[model samples]
Target: MNQDAIEVRGLTKRFGRRTAVEDLSFGVARGSIVGLLGPNGAGKSTTLRAIVGLLRPTAGDCLIDGAPFSALENPATHVGVHMDGFGFETGITARRHLEIIRLAAGAPPGRVDEVLEEVGLADDAGRRVKAFSTGMAQRLGLAAALIGSPRTLILDEPANGLDPDGIRWLRRFLRGFVERGGTVLVSSHQLAELEQVVDEVIVIKRRALFAGRLDDLIRNDVDSLESRYFDLVEGAQA
Candidate 1:
């Protein structure tokens, strides 16, 4: 098992003349939760997509467990990625969605029940996903990510539509997940919310600006990550 759950070396992406990400390099240690902090259009989502092999980097590499992402046959077992705007079929119940993933992954039948309850979706298991509130759908997305018991989880703006209680549950759940030796990489605009759960954060403005311990990054001048984020981006603009 590699100590580094994720590694990106000189990763760069370009869409025509626009550079979404530039010379990005970072490592996420196993059993750690890393917050990818950036303003909108700062390449956070593009970086994530590159990590999961959804979008190939125009330059450099993204590795999972010491191997390139393209080398993995069953990427789902190695990585679970939950991006924004992914919705379930209207007719499928939450429980049934779990069943489908369980069957596809060949995971144990009990795993479905476990994660459903873990994400606070057990009560809504039988309810069709279309009827689920935004928070409930977010919970369901989390449950799906947990189904394969992936070693690494990548989530983008996961708290987008969640309520306070749901956000609290997610914070606790992610903390527990890392405690149990899982690696998590999350991107969110809710810097305050992330401050409550993240162990480390990678702050980027147009490109990689700061990558280090959360405390160290906030030391001296910046009082908090949110404050630091604004400072960094504004500084970049200036």
Candidate 2:
């Protein structure tokens, strides 16, 4: 039987009196790309953070490959995460930044250049991080994530700064990643772009509104993903 790559089980989080995520649960099957979709501040980030052990959830835990992220042996090799507020030292070159991560992951030294090229950042390897454009920075973040050779990637809004060409490249890259037996859980607001790549999608707003195959969510070809999403989200509004 195929194991789920990620499992968010009854995960709930609250800061003081404000509940961010409540009982948000879902699964990402191995070798698949799953989209985490929600309107702004719908606890997407909280769910992801809990999955990666970045913060302690108030009511639940997340499991990766059947183990909690903190419990996985050689955790970096099991999962790679790229999110907002990834602190990068502005003074270092992109190559140096990735080299540091690769070394820390105990990955082969040469993986740095290989991953940089994989993310289309080879030419900019020597450029200081401070000089990088938004898209370039996003690429650098991806390179850092892949440097560990993890089986799964958890990315939040990775396509935010990419131009159309770069977005297309990202779509192909993600598909190729899953084809190679890797898994991905990505959160992005670009529903149209996401519709092209994700096999399953988890839509949430402080709670899960939907979770299942993209086709099932759309119902039929006549209905669009965006239109269906609006209906779901709007219907949930109080």
Candidate 3:
């Protein structure tokens, strides 16, 4: 992995008097899959929003490829994002939705079809989102993220409603994405699934608690991701 594909330097965000995140800092290595782990109310969503320019941090900044997200010439070409609220138009067909996003991203005309197939939704492209299942909606969100053909992906709960088979497919897809020279920073509550694919891990609770490789974090203690995660989250409360 190249040095600091993404860098968050002293990030802080606040809503009026309440602090959401404070002095958080970390780096996502290029061409690597990093899992951002934290329990609910940990400010994970706030941090991701700041990173993608959806919201401004009260202090510090997030840089993608050594430049702040807003500084990127064409952001869609460099960073792809799929967060909690995907805002899919339930009334529209999947293909139409993706085509709209592809146009907005300045992607090629055929890009929508490419992503549809990539996310295993080729046959359902013409189906309206309202008729789809939760798992299918998640897939559509992912397809929207890839429509830009970005080098880096930031996904939140990408496997939210997937079944065992779907989860397995997501794991393989994420690994394959990184192997193809893409970088990923994904947040998921599914520690078991996240553990299977991530090369590095970043755990946070309001601020950065830990950031490093999974192997180093566990150190062969028989305990692994979940154990370390509980330790980290619990420690933060102490």
Whole-model lDDT values for every prediction = 0.85, 0.91, 0.92
lDDT of 1 by residue, 21-125 (tens): 999999998988999988878899889888878788899999998888789867668887788755688798999988998787778989999998888878889
Q: How many steric overlaps does candidate 2 have? A: 0
Residue lDDT tens for model 3, 1-238? 4668799999999999989899999999998999999999898999999999899999998999999998998788889999887688889999999989988899999899899999999999999999999999999999999988899999999998899999999999989999999999999999988888999999999988899998888888588899999999998862
Candidate 2 lDDT over 1-238, as tens digits, reads 8879998889999999999999888899998899998898899998999999988999877999899988999888899989997879999999999988887898998999899889998888999999999999998899899988899999999998999999999999999999998999999999999999999999999999999999889877788778988988999964
Q: Each candidate: how many clashes?
A: 0, 0, 0
Model 3: lDDT to the true structure: 0.92
Per-model TM-score on C-alpha atoms: 0.94, 0.98, 0.97
Reference-based TM-score, model 3: 0.97
Work out candidate 1's RMSD over C-alphas.
1.8
Give the least accurate 10-residue stretch of model 3, judged by summed lDDT. Answer: 1-10
lDDT of 1 at 219: 84
Task: Name the candidate, 1 or 3, with the larger TM-score value.
Answer: 3
Ranking by lDDT: 3, 2, 1
